[model samples]
Target: MTTQDWWRGAVIYQVYPRSYADTNGDGVGDLPGIIAKLDHIASLGVDAIWISPFFKSPMDDFGYDISDYRDVDPLFGSLADFDILLARAHELGLKVMIDQVLSHTSAQHDWFLQSRESRTNDKSDWYVWADANQDGTPPNNWLSIFGGGAWQWEPRRQQYYLHNFLASQPDLNFHNPDVQQAVLDNVEFWLAKGVDGLRLDAINFCFHDAQLRDNPAKPVEARQGRGFSEDNPYAFQYHYYNNTQPENLPFLERLRALMDRYPGTAALGEISSEDSLATMAEYTQEGRLHMGYSFELLTNDYSAGYIRSTVETLEARVSEGWPCWSVSNHDVVRVATRWAQGEPSDAQCKMLTAMVCSLRGSVCLYQGEELGLPEAEIPFEQLQDPYGIAFWPNFKGRDGCRTPMPWQSEGEHAGFSDASPWLPIPESHRARAVSQQDRAADSVLNSFRQFMNWRKTQPTLMGGSIQFLDAPEPVLLFVREQGDERLLCGFNLGDKPVSLNIEQLGSAHTVLSDHGLREAQREGNVLAFPPYGIFFARLA
Candidate 1:
């Protein structure tokens, strides 16, 4: 890829600093810890590392509720520590992407403090504040994704402030041009810090309907998924008015224009709205975000038809924009457990990593995914994620996926920390620790390394258009073409063995079998696959 487009089709490893490593032994991972493990990240063959938020905060919603956008959180380390880590990552030929939560600020943030002091304050309109109804209730019926009503009553101003997440996370008023410029200025602070890109958090929630309209209720039967189950009231409405407003588009243009000032820097927005895929298409066009990703694939739907339909829908809508895919992240269950058809095998874990990586755009590989780690079951007593605690049995929350990274099999806390981790590391996860699979040739970790290295050589895989072929259940067939180079990719999505003849490739061109997924058997025109098998071949 060209220097300006280095992020195109790149495999960016996501590092959740809280779970990655701990150097101070304070039971939390920090920047110094990341510096200690740069070689391990480089060995995985990923192009960049998207570090989750580590800015100053009260840990209300972890680092997502940032109190200060300019400085590192003392719990994570000093700003100088982040600088050293950035230099080390660049030295190892890895780009660094930091998280930017542009839509909201911590209630304790100075901007919010000034805005909430009184209606007559200088920064009074900086946050989304509105007058309540005649009955003294919230202005509208917007629900917080975390739970309860989205509006929080601020007695200081005798008005309600909007919080799409925790009450501590107050939504910024993008309608205020000053707010947009301030958000962009904070973003530029990091871009000028020599970071390569940004993982924009809740970028779609930057604006709300200016009219403060009430969102229509979703049908009873359709009240599930999209990060919330039916048990959580957040799934009860269409959420049309609270976020994904059209005004956000021009603001994104401003963000993109600022990014353009720092050449080679890219922004990947996390979009979630009523029609997320369509919003993704709209947000990623020219003069806007470089890439957009949604929760379409992050759900429990593992059918080939669903995956094919999701990607194809976005493909149809996207023209000049790019898409980024992720099956697992810090917010949900790990792919190893979420998409398991039967007993989750190491093969399926490796296949899922490659499957997402093989898609038309860039990939975000969550930390510990290379080790094939499953979600840890955290008890209510040990739950740290408020979302899980609020919903209880219906939704176990994100702590299952946010547990500490298991670096060693034989250690107090899987070598993640000397003190007790914020979230407990599962005993099963310890068995799949990095030390256990670092050298095992057939291990999922090694297979991931092998595939990523080989993928770098396939220019077609890096920049090609994907067309999903009509294949039977348990099998997904797709052809990626870039100029004259065509690579046929197929995978067995189930536990049973499958054998089928694909007459599409009449000449049966060279089978690109050197990608280390060496088990897909091809006999003449028939392809046979074991459980969770993968196949990649170059067309004649």
Candidate 2:
């Protein structure tokens, strides 16, 4: 693919900076450490690497709460180290996409500090500040995703400020032209640094209702988990007024205009709204976000019908815009554990990778997903994620998926860090380490690499129109066609064996096979797939 369309149908590997690798032995991963692992990332046959936030922060919400937008955190490394990482990644033919948390910033950020000082300050209106009600309560009944009321009282301004996430992460007033310009300027700074693209965090939250209207309460059945469960009270409201404002469209156009100045660059937005699919469609329309993804697939729903409906809905809604899909990421439970009805298996991991990669548009494969890593159980005392600490037992937060990537099978902290890792590495994860998988031909890691490389050669699979075939419950069949090529992909999305007729699927020839078990052999035109089996064929 050319530079202009390189991100189209691309596979971008997501690397959570804190857990990827550590070079300084500070028990935390850094930019230099990422540079050290560039070769391994390239070996996966991915087009780009989306590194999570490494910006200067107080770590209240990890690196999501940025104190300095233009500089790298000391914990990650200096700006020079980041430049080296960009250079090395480009040398390996991997586009580097950095995180851009545009919706909010740490309360400690200079802008927030100045804005919170007094209403007369130049930056006073840069953040969402509102007056308290006559009853000395918040201006509205909006709630934070992290729990409790979304408003935080500021003594200096004698007003309440909105915080959709952690209180430390105060929402920015995107309605202010200056704030939008400043955000664009910060993005321009990275583009000037020769970065390839940006992963826009909470892009939907960029704009909020100007009137500060109270969000209506959501019915119990209408609620869906964005970050927290229904028990957190965050899911109790419709969230219509607080976010997903119509004004977000024009601001995205402004952001896209900035991106256009830097040729070959792309923007992949992370959207979480009540109608996330609809928002994704709107944000990715021409002249807005280039690609967009949501938490629809990351949820615990694993049925074939559910997956088909989700993709079909997005495909219908998103006309000119492209879609990016991810089954696992830093925020949710690993797919290996979430989708598995019982113990996770290597076959299930390989199948999941194949399924997501086969979809239209691009893909974001989370770090450690290649090894079929399950969520690591973190003890309450060892939990580092503040979200986890606040809601334990029912919702253990994101620490389970944020555990350090295991590099070596036998070593202190599994070779992620010389010192203790930020989060404890599960002993079970050691068995699936890169070192161990590198030597095994049938390992999940090897299968992922093979499948990814194989996908690159299939134009039909890369950028094809998908059509779901009518199949039984446990089996999902889809035909992806591009130009003259048509490839049919079938997956046994269950633990039990399934049987179907190849003739019924049309005249097709098996082109690829992974290490999936087949209890009964294919008889005549009949095909039998064992648990988590994957089959790829080309239609004649």
Candidate 3:
């Protein structure tokens, strides 16, 4: 791939800055710490790094609530530190993509501060402000993802402002042309700073229904939508009027236009709507987002059929855009724990990585995923996420997945920090630390490195069109072809072994190893798979 298209089918490593590494003994990771750890990230053989939010924020949503778009948060170092980090990453042949939370701003932001002070203020219309009913209720019945109503009562303006997320993270009014221009200006700041691309946070939530219509109620049996579970009241409604509005497309085009001005810089949007897959298709078509991904794979559904149907559904809807697939991120439970029938095994975890990477798009591998880190069990007393606090034991929020990375087996707090880390590093993770894995040749971390390095040698695996083959339960089969090169890929997602007859090969195939995965024994049309086994064959 050329410099301009480097993101196409690229393996992007996601680094949640708060959990990556802490250099200032402040119990939090920073830009300087990420810079210090660039060598380790580069060793993983990923094409780029996608750093989570580190911009100036109140840390209300753990840096997602941006108070200043152009400056780095004091908790995560300054602008100078970021520039140094960016330069160091480039020197190590790693592209840098930072998170851009454009849909909302911190309640403390100057724009919101001024807008909330008085109705006649210059920035009054900068946010979504609407009048309440005669009974003094909210303008609409939209519920916040965190909990409660999406509308917050601003006493100064005597009106409710929309906030699809937390009340502190008020949604920006894209209806205002000035707000649109201002958002683009903030995005241009980083692009001008020589950063490679942006991971747009909730890009579809930029515009709301101008009519302020109420969302339709979902049936009681309906459990989830827009990545929220039944535990969240936000899932009770269809969320039609509050987000994924048609007006957002023009705004995306405007954002795309800015990114085009800076060559080699792309936009990877994070989408979640009523129908996230369909929204991803619409958002990335034409001159909009460069690539898009939804939370379908991030959910707890782990099966061969579910995975196949999800990708095929998106592939059918998408015409001119690319998709980015990820099984693990900073949200929900880790893949090692979520997909495991019981206790997760190293072999199963490695197979999971290989499985997701084999899909037909770019991949986002979250930090600590290489070590097959299971989700840490965060006690209620130790929980920091407000969303988690609101949901409690029934639905433990994202704090479990947001714990600090384990860097060493013997060091205090796994060498993540000298002080007590923000979230406790699970004791189980110490055994899977980077230090321990570096010495073990058969470690999950080592297998990850080996497979990624090998994947680079196969052009078909990188950017090839995918065709999933029909197979039995716990077995995902597919064919990836680019030009004359065709490779048959299969994964046993279950814990136990199984034997199946796959006549799809027609016996004209070569069993290819060297991906450092468990092997599959073949006899004529019968192939036997071990626990979490992988099969790759070069088809003639």
Candidate 4:
């Protein structure tokens, strides 16, 4: 495929910076560390690498609360190091995409500092600030995603500043044309630096209800578990007024227009909304975003029906727009453990990988996913995630999934650091380290490589029409067809064996299997699948 079309249905690997690699021995992963590991990432046959935020920050949200948009954080390294990393990634034939947190900024950000200093400052209107109500409470009843009221009283301005997430990370008023322009300038800065694309953080939270109205509470019946904890009062309201407002569409158009100026640059937005799937479809429709993904598959629902219904719903809703799919990321529990019934198994990991790649969208593979790593069981004492600390055993936050990438088996801290690592490297992770898997041909890492390499050879798998097949529960069956070529992809998401009639599917050649299990003989018409088996075939 041409470089321009590289991300179309491509697999983009996500690397969480603080846990990916720590080169300077400061217990934190840096750009130099990422630069040192580009070869290993490229060897996976992924089309691109989407590194999470490494911009200058207070790290209240671990680089998501950006203090500076133009330069790399001192903790990560300098702009020169970033340039070196970008050059190394391009040399390895990998496209580089950076996370852009445009919706909010650290309270320490110069703009925010100025905005919060006084009411009459030139940048006072840059952030979302409003006067307190007569009762001396917040403007409205909006709750922060992190915790507490979304508005924080500013003593200097005698008003409250809006924060959709953590109070330290104040929301930018995209309603202000200047704020939009400044954020776009940041985008231009990265594009000028030769970055391939951006994974826009909380893209839908760019705008809010102008009237500062209270959001209506979601009825108890409608409040089925949607990933956020009930402890986080943010889940109580429908979130109609705070985010995903209709006004956000024009800003997306403007952002897309800026990205269009830079050739081969794409935008994959991260949309978290009450109706995320519907919003994902809306965001990627026409001139808005190139593509967007939601928390649909990121949740704990591992059933075949849930996966099928989510994709089918998207396909039906979004005809003109493309979709990007991911089973796990930094925010959710690792799929290995989330889907694991008893003890974690490599077979289940391989099945999950196959299932994600088989879906009809561009894929995003998180760091350590190739190793089939389960969520690290972090002790409370070692936990750095405030969210985890707040919820304790109930949720465990996201620190478990954000632990350091295990590079070696025998070394201290899994060789992720010569010094103490930022987050504790789980003892369980050491067994699946890269060094151990590098020597084994049948390792989960090798299986990932094989599946991805094989996937690249098929145009149908790359970008094709998906047709859900009539299959039993726990067995996801679909056909990916492009022009004259068609492939039958079947996955057994359960431990029990399942069977389907391959003669009914016509004569076909078995092409790939994660278990290395050959297709069973077609006894008249039925073809059987063993536990956790995956089968890929092309019609004869």
lDDT of 1 by residue, 433-465 (tens): 899998677888888888888898988888999
TM-score of 3: 0.98
- Cα lDDT listed for each candidate: 0.90, 0.90, 0.91, 0.87
Which residue segments of model 3 deviate by more than 4 Å? 507-515
List model 4 lDDT by residue over 1-540, tens digit each.
Answer: 466766779899999989988989999999999998898999998999999999889998899999999988899999999999999999998999999999999999999989999988999899999988898988899998877789998999999999998889999999999999999998999999999989999899999899988999987767755556666677778899999999999999998888888879989999989888899889998888888878888877788899899999989889678899998899988989988978888877877887898888898889999999999888999988888887888878899899999999998889898989888888899889999998888888988888888888888898889988878888888899888988888888888778877554566777774433323344545778777878788865
Error of 3 at 313 (Å): 0.6
Measured against the true structure, the TM-scores of the candidates, in listed sequence, are 0.98, 0.98, 0.98, 0.97
Name the Cα RMSD for model 2.
1.4
- Per residue, candidate 2 scores C-alpha lDDT tens digits across 496-538 of 8899876644566777755332223456677788888778878
Tell me model 2's lDDT, rounded to 2 decimals: 0.90
TM-score of 4: 0.97
Model 4 misplacement above 4 A: 225-227, 513-522
lDDT of 3 at 310: 94
Candidate 2, which segments miss by more than 4 Å at Cα?
A: 502-504, 514-524
